[model samples]
Target: MDVVVARIGKAHGLRGEVTVEVRTDAPQERFVVGRSFTTDPAQAGPLRLRSVRDHNGITLLGFEEATDRTAAEALRGTLLVADVEEDEDDENAWYEKDLVGLRVLTVAGEEVGEVAGVDSRPAQDLLVVRLASGREALVPFVEALVPEVDVEGGRVVIDPPAGLLELDEG
Candidate 1:
């Protein structure tokens, strides 16, 4: 399966480097030198990474195909995708790719939302769910809150405590 690792941002300087909006949790592992990625438009890449740098906590990437500012600018808004192999051994952990787009439901089978993304934080990971009412909720990715993740069934069973789901609401 192809998982988006980052999106190309503005051209950083004259030498083909571009700032990237990282989409994955493992940026250090993904943005290595000589790593290649396929692009969303299917034409901007397969781009090979020639350089990777960090400036003020921003990730800057240089592609072999993009040798100048004009070349880098052309890649703006392009998503960098990498092929991922699902780990059969680790049944407990779900990749951010696997979690996104899954149906969110209550234990009673009430449809609540769809998972928009996973927020990897220092304290705990959050399941960013786009609710049926169009508001987004950040459910803590814990066993107490999320009891079941049925990937093949395409649903996640969440048991939110009182007022937990309404925390994001106005």
Candidate 2:
């Protein structure tokens, strides 16, 4: 359930602060003083957050052990992750991590596929569904097309417009 929260960028200053490009939607909640996270290289650390600040629209972080500029500089390009969390108000909403294995179906209960991945893009996010034919279907993750998401039922109901499924079905 470890989800990528941010990627460490260049060293910010001699104060052991490093710039971090946030990956999570809730950056403020993920990166804060005393917060802790494990890294990718496995050797970098299960870093503990020392400080967080903003500069020129960039997020900067200071970890407990990265006490010097040289120490922080060595952590460039590191990824930060946190445990998955759920909220009671999360009805009809889902995180990409939680959607990866859900079943996909037409509104009428016809099976379409299983969710293999989710592509987050600038224009729109897409659900990468593995169809029954062993091929992939890229469905736009818009509310108009995907009207229902039943996480408990482990299925998503998609109401695609005409000719939409045809594009990937062939």
TM-score of each: 0.78, 0.65
lDDT per residue for candidate 2 within 1-170, as digits (tens), equals 68877779898779899988776667778887998899987799899999998888778899998999999999998988788666668675567777888999999899999999877544677888888888888889989989988878899899888877778453
What is the per-residue lDDT of model 1 for residues 1-170, given as tens digits with 9 covering 90 to 100? 78888889999999999999887667888998999999999989899999999999888999999999999999999999998766689777787877889999999999999999987554688999999999999999999999999999999999998887888576
Best by TM-score: 1
What is the lDDT of every predicted structure here?
0.90, 0.84
Worst 10 residues of 2 by lDDT: 117-126
